[model samples]
Target: MATRARPSACSHTDRVFLYADSLIHSGGVPKLCPGHGAMPPPEGQNMINESALLESQSLRNSVLERTDVLDRVKALSLLPDGMHVTTAMVATYFGVGLEAIKSLVKDHRTELEANGYQLLAGEELRSFKNLSGLQSHTRSLAIFSRRAVLNVAMLLRDSEVARQVRMYLLDMEYLARTQPVDNPVHRETVSLDDRIDQRITHILGKTVVPMFNALIETSGEHRKELIALRAGVQRIERRLHQHHTRLQRLEGVRDDRPTVGVMAAMDAMNGRRFEHHIAKLLHRDGCTDVVVQGGRGDRGVDIIGLTAAGQRLVVQCKRFAPYLNITSPEVQKFVGAAKVLHNADVALYVATCPFTPEALSIAAETGITVVHRGLLEEWSAGEPLEVLE
Candidate 1:
C-alpha cells in the first residue's frame, strides 16, 4: 500500500498556474505539477521590498534619536518673554552650526514668532548684559538665521573666541570710521585719524579694559594680581602707541624721513619725560635697579633694569598720542632684540597706550610681559608691585 503523497509546500494557486503554463507550452491538457509548491513570497512583499522596509526602520530610529535635538531647540525658543537669546548660546545648546541654527529660526520665523520667540537684532543684542543677556540674545538670533547661528557657534566654540571677538570689534569700529572717506585727500586728513584714534581709545577704556581689570582683581594672590594688572596696563599703552604709528603711516610719513622730524623729536622728549616719571615712581617704591633708556642701539628696547631678586628686565616705550594700538609683531621684534642685546630674564613692553589682543597673545606666548598706560597710572598711584619670590 502506497502512502498518500505529502501535500506540496507551494500554494494550490501557484501549483495550478505552473501546471497550466507547462500544458499550454506542450499542447496538452494541464496536469498537477510536481514540486511546484514553495512558501508564499515573504509577507508584505507586494507593498514594500525588503530593502525599503529596512530603510523605513532606519528612518524611524533616526527620528527618535533626533527627538532630543528638536526638543532642545524648541525649549530654547521659548525663553522668558523679555529675555533675549544669543546665536552663540543657541548653537552651544543644540551643538549645531550657528548659521544653521540661525537659518532654522529664520526659515521658521512665523512659527517661532507664534511660539513667542523673537529674533534679537545685532544692535539690540549689544545692549544686553555682557554675561547671560548677551549669550541669550545670541542664541535667539542663531535660531533665526542658520548662517548666523553656525558662524556664531563656531566663534563661541573657538578656544580663542575672546581674542577673535575683540579683534573683530576693533576692525569693525575702525572700518566704520574710515569707510566714509573716499578721496585720498580726505583719507589723509588729521581729523579723520584723530577721530578714529579717539573712538578706539574709547572702546578700549570702556569695554576691554574693564574686562581685563575684573580678571586682574579676581586673582587670589597679591603678586598674581599685580602681575596681571601691570600686564593689562601695558597692553592698553601699546594699543594707543599703535594707533599713533598707524596714523603716521597713513599720512605717508616715512620712518626715517625728516617730514615728521619735529613731531618725532617732540615724541622723544615726551618719552624721556614719561620714563623719568616712571623711574622716579619705581625708585620711590623700593625698586633699586630701575634704569631708563639704558640700552644701546637703534632697536626699540628703551629701558633695562633689574628686579630686587636680580631678575633682569628690558623695557620698550612708546609715547605716541593716546589711542594708538600696537601689533604683536612689533612687540616680538622688540623682545627678540632685547633678549639678544641685554640677555635679560624678562622683557617688559611699556607704552603710553594699549596693545591689541594679537599683541597680548604674542607677548603671552613669547614670555614677554607688557606694561600699559593703566598700569603706569596705578603704579604712580602708589599701588605696590608685589614681589614674587
Candidate 2:
C-alpha cells in the first residue's frame, strides 16, 4: 500500500487540528470550515472557551489595576534618597490601626517586592510600632502610615497617582504638626489640680489679658473701654476666688509636708510674699486652719486645711507652663497621698494653667475638684468665688 503523509504533531497547524477535535468532542457540534474543506477546531479552542477567555482577561486586568494602586501608594512613601517609607508616617496617613497596617504590609510583601517596592526596614518599622504603642490610637497610626505611603509613591511612581498622593500627604502633615497631638499619654503622671491652675494662668496670660489689652488699645472712648476692661477683670477675679476655695478644701489635710520648689517660683510669679497667699486669704475668710507649705510624709499633697465642720481637705498645687498639661496619674498620686496621710474628705487640685480635658474629666469622676489660676486670683482678692462653679 502507498504511504500517506502523516501530519506533524508539533506543528501549529496540527495543534489547531487538535483544538477543533476537542471542541467537537465536548458537545460542540462539529461544523464544516467556512473556506477550507472540513477541518478540526483550533488548539486554542481546547485550552479556553470564549466566555472563559473573556473572564480570565477581565480578572487579569482587575489584578493589574489593584497592583497599580498599591504601587502608587508605595511610591509616594519613599524619600528622595530612596529610603523605604516609615511605617509610622504611613499608618498616620491611612487612618487605620498601626498593627493592622503592619500586618497588611507583611501579608503583601511578595506582591510589593514583585512590583519593585521594598517593605519598610525593621528599624524604621520598630519606631512606628513604638510611636503607635505610646500614642495608643488608630487615628494617629493611620495618618502616619498614609503619609509614608504617599512619600514612597512620589519616589517610585511618576504617574498622576503620585501627584495626588503627594498633595494629600502634604496637607495631612501640615495638620499634624500644626494641631495639637491628642492626649499624647494614655495615663497621666502629673497632678490634675496643677493642670487646672496652669490652664487658668494660660488663659489669663494668652487669652484674657491680651484680649482686654487689645480692646483697651483699640477703643476710641477711654471710659467705655475702661469699664469693659474692668468688668472683664472682675469676671476673672471672681473665677479665681472660686478656684481658691476649692483648693483650700482639697489641701486641708496635708498640713505638715515640706513645700516643693515650684511653690516658691509660683509665689514670686504672682508677686506674693509666700506661695501660700491663697491659703492665707482663705483662712482670713473663715476657711481657717489652712496651713501653708504644710503636709508631712505625703508624696503629692502640698497644702493642708480643715473646715470648721472638721472636714479634712488635701490640696496639690501645680505651677506648670500652658503647653505642658497635667495627666491622670498625677491626680491619682495626690488622691492616694490624701488617703494615706490625712484621710481627708476632699481632694483639690490648684494649677496656674489649665487642666487637660482628660484630667478635668478624671477629677470630676474621682471627686477631686480643680481650681484654675483665675479662680485663685478671685479667692485671693476676697471676691465672690461663685462664678467658677
Worst-scoring 10-residue span by lDDT in model 2: 172-181
Q: State each model's C-alpha RMSD to the native.
A: 30.2, 32.5
Task: Supply candidate 1's per-residue lDDT for 107.
Answer: 56
Report residue 289 deviation for candidate 1 (angstroms). Answer: 3.9
Which segments of candidate 2 are over 4 A away from where they belong?
A: 1-267, 270-274, 294-296, 384-389
lDDT measured at residue 389 in model 1 versus the true structure, 0 to 100:
26
- Output the worst ten-in-a-row residue range by lDDT, candidate 1: 64-73
Q: Write the per-residue lDDT of candidate 1 for residues 204-245, one digit (tens) a residue.
A: 444444444444334334424444444464366456745554
Q: Give each model's whole-structure lDDT.
A: 0.46, 0.45
Top-scoring candidate (lDDT): 1
Taking the tens digit of each residue's C-alpha lDDT, what string does model 2 give over 301-326?
A: 77777764567866787765422457
Total clashing pairs for each candidate: 55, 84
